[model samples]
Target chain A: MKYKVTESENISTVFLDGEIDMDVADNVREVVFPLIDSGKEVHLNLKGVQYMDSSGISVIVESNQRAKEKNTKVELKEVSQPVEKVLAMARKFL
Target chain B: MNTEATNLSEKKDFLVRSSSLKDVRSFSREVFEKFKIDENLREELVLAIAEAAQNIVKHAYKDYPDTQDRMAVRISCTDKELEIAFFDKGKPVEESKVKHRAIDDVKPGGLGTFFIQEIMDSIKFKEGDKPWINNLVLTKKL
Candidate 1:
């Protein structure tokens, strides 16, 4: 998986591409945590993401929670069919 | 690769083999489409199955570093519901402990199993010698 981080003004956008699975969870966490901790508004772009699993969902959810704590809002944008489905199902439980 | 022979002899098979989590979503979409599953239900079923399959890869086979020992996911559906099963040669999960976690938390990390249970109509886990099979059955009213 490949991720690129870009910041403009008060919003930080994380553009994710490729597959998000168990193998990439730790790497994703490492990249996302610092930016989130910096207390900037975050937006996750899933347009290029080809796949997603529970591990990936978990990472996103955790990031959302962290962002919430810092009063930073995290929004999901341009999600693919698969990632959108995962998020929808997750919303039922969370 | 003989194109003519391949086209003539090709059999339509729904089975998907995945070693990485990346393949799960795409495979789920293919299976859902083949079954003529509804658009709304297709979304839910894919997510539920993806999460279940990912858990099998992450926790069940954590000790096995080799890709050869990874889990296998099988999905089949009738007119009413989609059934997804995960087979792995790894440790069996404690059902009692898992059930407790389902109701306790709403956050992201520990709720994979719970989310699968709630999204799917029925969930069954079978544990035995050497290889353990975790099956998740999801039903969408069509």
Candidate 2:
């Protein structure tokens, strides 16, 4: 996956582009976690993401939990149709 | 449009690695398109197929990360139902140990199996006939 991050004051918006699976979940965490650890609100822009599997969903859930622990928040933005469908399937968990 | 015959089947084999998950989804999407499945349902089927394939890579081959083993995915569709079968030579799966965690647990790792169970009408684990060691069959009414 290719990602671009823009920082505006405290919030960092991460633009993730590509298919997300187990192969790329770690990289995604590596990118999004540090920002969350810094206690900054994070926005994940999923407009360019074409597909995401259960592994990717795990990253989102873990990130949300971690953000809560650190007193920060992670928001999903511009979720693509494919990714949204999977997220919808796991709505109760979220 | 009736783009395909009444009965259709396609199968593909891929390296049993996390990276191959994309190829698995691609193959599934292609087959669904050829079968003229609607977009929304097609995506759900692809997600179900990919999750099952991911289980093979994550659980079955957990010990053989660098092994050169490959797994096969077969999708067959008829007028009334669609069946997907996965063939792998990885560790034998004890059917008793293959349950998805409780949905209310709100955990990360176990959601794959939950999604599969939610999407497919029935899931069965059977012994492979030959060199293959594990076979998971999932079916849904089309």
Candidate 3:
């Protein structure tokens, strides 16, 4: 997966591209976690992401939990259709 | 490619590792497209198949990440039902212990099995005969 992060006053928006699976979940965490640790609201832009499995969903879940602990927030933006479908299924379990 | 073919079967094997999950999905999409499955359901089936394969790489072969084992995925379809089978030589799967984390328990790790259950109609685990240890079958009515 490829990512680009932009920072504004107190928020970091991470734009992720390519497929997010078990192979790339750690890389995603590496990119998104420290930003959350910085106590900034993080926006994960999923517009370029073509596919995401449970592993990807796990990253989002863990990030959200981490943000809550850090007194920040994580939001998903421009979620692609495929990812939206998977997220919908995951919402059932949440 | 016969889109109208009612009875179809395709099998492919990949080295058992997290990196091969993309290839698994590619093969699945090819088979589903050739079989003319609905576009709306194609991605869901792909997710279900990928999660099952991920389980093999994650749980069954947890300790053997660098091992040179291979797993096979077979997708077969008839006029009324679609069946996807996974054969892996990793550790044997314990059926009774394979439940997903409790619904109210919000966590990351156990959702793969939950997604499989949500997307597929049935899930069955069997002991493989030879050269394989775990056989997982997931089916959905068409």
Candidate 4:
């Protein structure tokens, strides 16, 4: 996966591109976790991401939990259709 | 427009590694397209297939990431149902211990199995005959 980050005063928007699976979940955590740790609201731009598996969802879930602990938040933005479908299925469990 | 025959089947083997999960999805999409499966249902099937494949890579081969093992995914469709089977030679799967975490526990790690359960009609784990150790079969009605 490929990612680009944009930072404002207190929020970091990460534009993630490519398919996300177990192979790339750790890399995603590596990218998003520190931003949450810095007490910044993180916005993940999923416009370019067309596929995300459970592993990717785990990253989102973990990031959300961690953001809550850090007193910030992580929001998903411009979620693609495929990812939206997966998220809809995951929402059943969440 | 799906005039293709319903009695279709395809199988492919991938290296049992996390990186091969993409290849597993790609192969599944190709077979689904060839089989003329419903457009709306294709991605869900792909996700189910990829999740099962990921389980093999993550759980079965947990101790041997560098091993050159390969796992096979076979997708077969009959007139009444679609069946996807996974054959792996990794550590034997303990059927009793394969349940997903309770929904009340809300966690990141167990969603794969949960998603599989949600998408597929039935999931069965069987002991493979030879050369393979675990046989996972997931089916959905067409």
- Tens-digit lDDT string for candidate 3 (B15-86): 999999999999999999989888888889999999999999989998998989999999999878999999
Best-to-worst order by TM-score is: 3, 4, 2, 1
- DockQ comparison, 1 vs 4, better candidate: 4
DockQ, all models: 0.38, 0.56, 0.66, 0.66
lDDT of 2 by residue, B1-142 (tens): 1445468899999999988988998899899888877676887888899889988987899899997999999988887788999999999999898877665454434688878988999999999989899999999987
Off by over 4 Å in 2: B1-4, B102-109
Tens-place lDDT digits, model 3, residues A59-89: 9988999999999999999999989988998
User: How many residue pairs clash per model?
Assistant: 0, 0, 0, 0
| Candidate that scores best on lDDT | 3
lDDT of all the models against the reference? 0.66, 0.88, 0.91, 0.90
Q: How high is each candidate's interface RMSD, in Å?
A: 4.0, 2.4, 1.9, 2.0
Off by over 4 Å in 3: B1-3, B103-109
- Tens digit of per-residue lDDT, candidate 4, span B49-108: 998998898889989999898999999997778999999999999988887777545443
